[model samples]
Target chain A: MTHTEAGRYLRLVVAEEAPRTGDTPDSGARRVWEIAFGLAARRRFETDSPLAEIGRTVTAAVRSAALPLLEAEMLVREALGEQVPVDGIAESVRTAVHLLVFARLADELALTDDELDSLIAQAEELAAAGISPRSEPTGVP
Target chain B: MGQTGTLYTAAGRLLLDALGEKSPARSLSHCAGSPGAVRLLRELFTVAVRRGFVGRDPRDITAYVRDLLDYQSLPAGGEFARQAEAVMRSVLGEPEVAYAVSDRRRFELICLMVGDLVRPPGVPTGELVALMRQAERRAARS
Candidate 1:
């Protein structure tokens, strides 16, 4: 997946809530994780928000979405500057965290549509610059 | 069931030490080198999960671990969380997940979770001891 393709899928997922029909499942899935992790790297919680508070927010959002709780824990840890072993986690769990975490961070930050678009654009630039690999998305950080 | 001699003693000692320690996770590291203690801890962990969490959704284990980490002020994700969840689920009949966790970390996680079964104002000591005794029997038989 090229950087442009990564950006396109990020828009598709965030805007349409799923990938479009023509997108290959493999590339689409990879983009989903890449975009999610990239956005997480850019997310900024409230300055006063403690780690426990961030954990609660992430956990509540994940539980409400009916995603796996372990996924929520992983997301919280990642948001707190921990290097989570995404490769070792189950794909289904990773995908769920990807989708839910992207949405939750967006909600938490209350980004306007234009701002969200800009974030995606920045991610695309970062991806193109090799912040993350095209063949394997390791996240934007 | 009768206790299995030294295994029972060692298991009970570990549990008590964990319960009494201000920093159980840190203290557990000191005992991680003891193969016998590690084996007993795994058996006790399986018994604790089976007794405490069976018949509930597997997600409860995740929630419990989250709460445990929160109370201990430990970071909640990474390889430790993944391996910890896998080890707990392994006892709940999904044995394959256990293979992904390393031996040392697995032993430490077992100690953490098994010790968690009797946190303050949590499970009564007598009941926990009985549960440990049951695990001892299961280990002896196997």
Candidate 2:
């Protein structure tokens, strides 16, 4: 899929304010995952807050959504800058984690609407520029 | 056995200190600066979990972590909870999950679990020390 198309789909998934139609389910799912991955790549916990504490908040949020314990742990680790092995995980599970974690992270940071829009815009710009979310450098070592 | 002896002694001291502290898990943070101390603590943690929890339901470990965190008023479902479960499970024969945890956090978790193993009215100090030595010997032979 073209980066522009992917970005549009991502914006739809992140905002979820409008119905998304047109892209096939497969392609739509992939784009949403990409957007979640892109958002996660951005450092959302670099403030005075401890990573562990942030991880707890994110984990609690994800678990409350009824995601299984292991999957919730994986999402928390990924959000906290750990390179969790996702290759073996199911696409559907990975997608859920990505979406939930991305949303929880936004909530945790208390991002203003403008800031959220800016981040989505940045993600769109990167997508349009052909940047892969996986290639983005994360803050955690 | 010599290295194990030193580790055993250090583990015993740390456990005692943790048991005495009102906030046992938080008290473990002091050893976070010393990699050597952390390593000893990790080994001690492995021994403690193996001795105290082997053959028990893995879910019990999860419940135990939840209770431990709840007692301390800490959040029970984040990195700390995950790491605590992973660390215990690793020692329980699922070692790979432990790799997902970072060293600093892993050390912190090892301290927390090790401290939990000795929380008041839990394992007696001498019995716990004996278990550590026996486990170390078995591990060395293998």
Candidate 3:
């Protein structure tokens, strides 16, 4: 419905769920990111394959990269244990992490292990080839 | 008998419930924070799940957004914007779908109903179907 109504509903749901665990921030971050990653995967690349091990691999990158940037990663663990309520602080943290990493790793399927091994080669040919990133814009004129 | 535990241990139902449970609050402030920014959007999705509006296809939503944007020749960021814009225009023209759902669930309902139009990815051929068949046989054994 309206933006505020949804927020109200979210608070109620979050209230019912157990708060996040205090221990193991790493797992907590990992779990919440998993949902954001799922949303991004569904909406971004249009592929469900992102739900598999490869998705997990990509998630591992986003989560580990973001853990250092977050302060409440541990306090938020229990909140993360539930599906991240739309209103929870963990939801924002998780999505912010996904946005940062997804911007870099967007065309993930195009990246191969072999290419990653040789950074200089890939970096040099970044624009020359296999969809590194969108240099030229589209849709908006 | 074997079907009882199918989605039982899985987080899918939990995720689905979260999607269904709450709608985000609205505010005029410029920043409700990061989760705040997407809170409304996530509620829309949860409603979608509750209504069975979303497809069972496993692609995560972000990746779907990326691919759909790329395909539409729209800037990736513009993808959701475009959809939101289009839906607005459609409602202005027709206005029927809104009546079918509660106001709080509208956005999520849209995502559920139309999110699949973003186009699904190629399947890994018969790989999964074969696996399912084998698993079914195993389940039948006991």
For model 2 the local lDDT of residue A27 reads 47
> Model 2 misses residue A102 by how many Å?
22
lDDT of 3 by residue, B1-142 (tens): 2325343212222322332332211221111233332343343333433333134322223234445445555454432422432233233322321232344344532443333322344223243233323333333442
Q: Which has the better DockQ: candidate 2, or candidate 3? A: 3
Deviation (Å) of B22 in candidate 2:
3.6
Q: Write the per-residue lDDT of candidate 1 for residues A57-134, one digit (tens) a residue.
A: 566556665665544554555544444433356665665566566767777777787777777676666645556522
RMSD of each: 10.7, 14.5, 20.8
Per-candidate TM-score, first chain only?
Answer: 0.63, 0.61, 0.26
Any runs in candidate 2 off by more than 4 Å, and if so which?
A1-69, A72-141, B1-15, B34-36, B132-142
Best by lDDT: 1
lDDT of 2 by residue, A54-91 (tens): 54655565666565445555554454445442334556
lDDT of 3: 0.33
Q: Which one wins by lDDT: 1 or 2? A: 1
How far residue B135's Cα lies from its native spot in candidate 1, in Å, is: 1.6
| DockQ of candidate model 1 | 0.09
Badly placed stretches (over 4 Å) of model 1 are A1-141, B1-11
Error of 2 at A8 (Å): 21
